[model samples]
Target: MKNLILTTAALALGAGMAMADTVRMGTEGAYPPYNFINDAGEIDGFEREVGDELCKRAQLECEWVKNDWDSIIPNLVSGNYDTIIAGMSITAERDEVIDFTQDYYPPTASAYVATSADADVTGGVVAAQTATIQAGHVAESGATLVEFATPEETIAAVRNGEADAVLADRDYLVPLVEESNGELVFVGDPVPLGGGVGMGLRESDAELRGKFDAAITSMKEDGTLNEMLKKWFGEDTATYAPDGSVVTN
Candidate 1:
């Protein structure tokens, strides 16, 4: 009876460990159409759908974690989460500290928006979210770069004239522009930046990364990824072709 009791206790402990292996998917809940808090206060957006599907396909129990954009990567490194499903672009600079699944979203352009179409985006003060590729590009583009902690603040800077323009992902800016009632407009030619968006994982989680990469590939091959992209980003958004190449509109 003593040996049986010990065995049962050990089995219970093992079951609890297995249950605790839920993968935490980190994201910035502020970025809409990517990841945001819905009316129900739950993570809801394209990444949420994609992440949930990936988790299902990979057979991994997953949960969503919201983190600030500025500290997202650092928190991931500190083991605050198991993966970053934020709309993080894959970059060589970031790859130094973390691993990434294969590209889930294709390379997209960054555009400058302002109150007028003729805003001096190339040579004027430009706002960008800090620590993003858009911010880095603005810093080197000969434009005076104003860094904001959040994407919303960058747009507010442009609206209030703190910056002449705000540079951000075209996909993120399109809806804002349309809803602006002519208050905002694209000011300059869209600049291509970053390779593509991918899931960021710790450097040590190669296996976990592989699972997601495979799930993404499966989605791509089955045309589900393209469907999701179009559903969230509009019909003209870039998508994966049958040959696995990106079909940009």
Candidate 2:
């Protein structure tokens, strides 16, 4: 759901890479609750906890690598990192270039936030993080779409009146709206987007992908994944059912 379109050459390069012993987990360390830098400046968030646990369950030695959101996929394909555990949604457009494990997080909605509850989200300017599904949706929704390099910048655009509203993942925006003290309010209905978030791997890394997929399955079956989802995204967050199926509103 985020990052640039991959080039054919990049995809070919990714397909030719050899497997390594240590799985380098790549992420954009800026999106809070999903992935972010904590106060002590180390990468810490829902993804870090989940990635660590997945690596443990898979019996793999993993290390974290922080990258800018815009270049995350390109860097992964170029061998800068082994897998992308960023808050990246699984979409057909993205799956064309890289392989994805079974979704670790359930499908969630994209929502709009503005200073006013009745903001003109449909026809007015809407800001979204660059190369995201929300940005693509805004572009095709008869609205003025403004793209930013980062999620924080999209919210800033709404606050500064550069855009009428900012559309982003509901999980990411919920805490901001609550902490805004009436400065920021939700406008318009939440739009369901993407399949779900998954770990991205090179197309040639089928064995690696299978390891992560199995680990994710175990987490879902045992309810650990649901517990992590609630811990980071609030108790009302969507989760896996008893049968290991995603249960979303």
Q: Relative to the true structure, how large is the alpha-carbon lDDT of every model?
A: 0.82, 0.86
Tell me the lDDT of model 1 at 93.
Answer: 67
lDDT of 1 by residue, 123-209 (tens): 999999887878877888899999888889999998998999998888899999999999999986888887788998887777788
Encode model 2's per-residue lDDT on 1-249: one tens digit a residue: 343434343444745335578889999999998999998989999999999999999999999999998788888888889999988988887888888998888888889999998899989999998878888889889999999999999999999999999989888898999999999999978998887889998898898898899999999989998889888888877899866687875
In candidate 1, where is summed lDDT lowest over 10 consecutive residues?
1-10
RMSD of each candidate?
10.6, 1.8
Query: Would you estimate the TM-scores of all the predictions?
Result: 0.90, 0.94
Q: Residue-pair clashes per candidate, as listed?
A: 0, 0
Candidate 2's C-alpha runs over 4 A off are 1-11, 14-17
After superposition, the stretches of candidate 1 with alpha carbons farther than 4 Å from their true spots are 1-20
Query: Cα deviation in Å at residue 182, candidate 2?
Result: 0.7
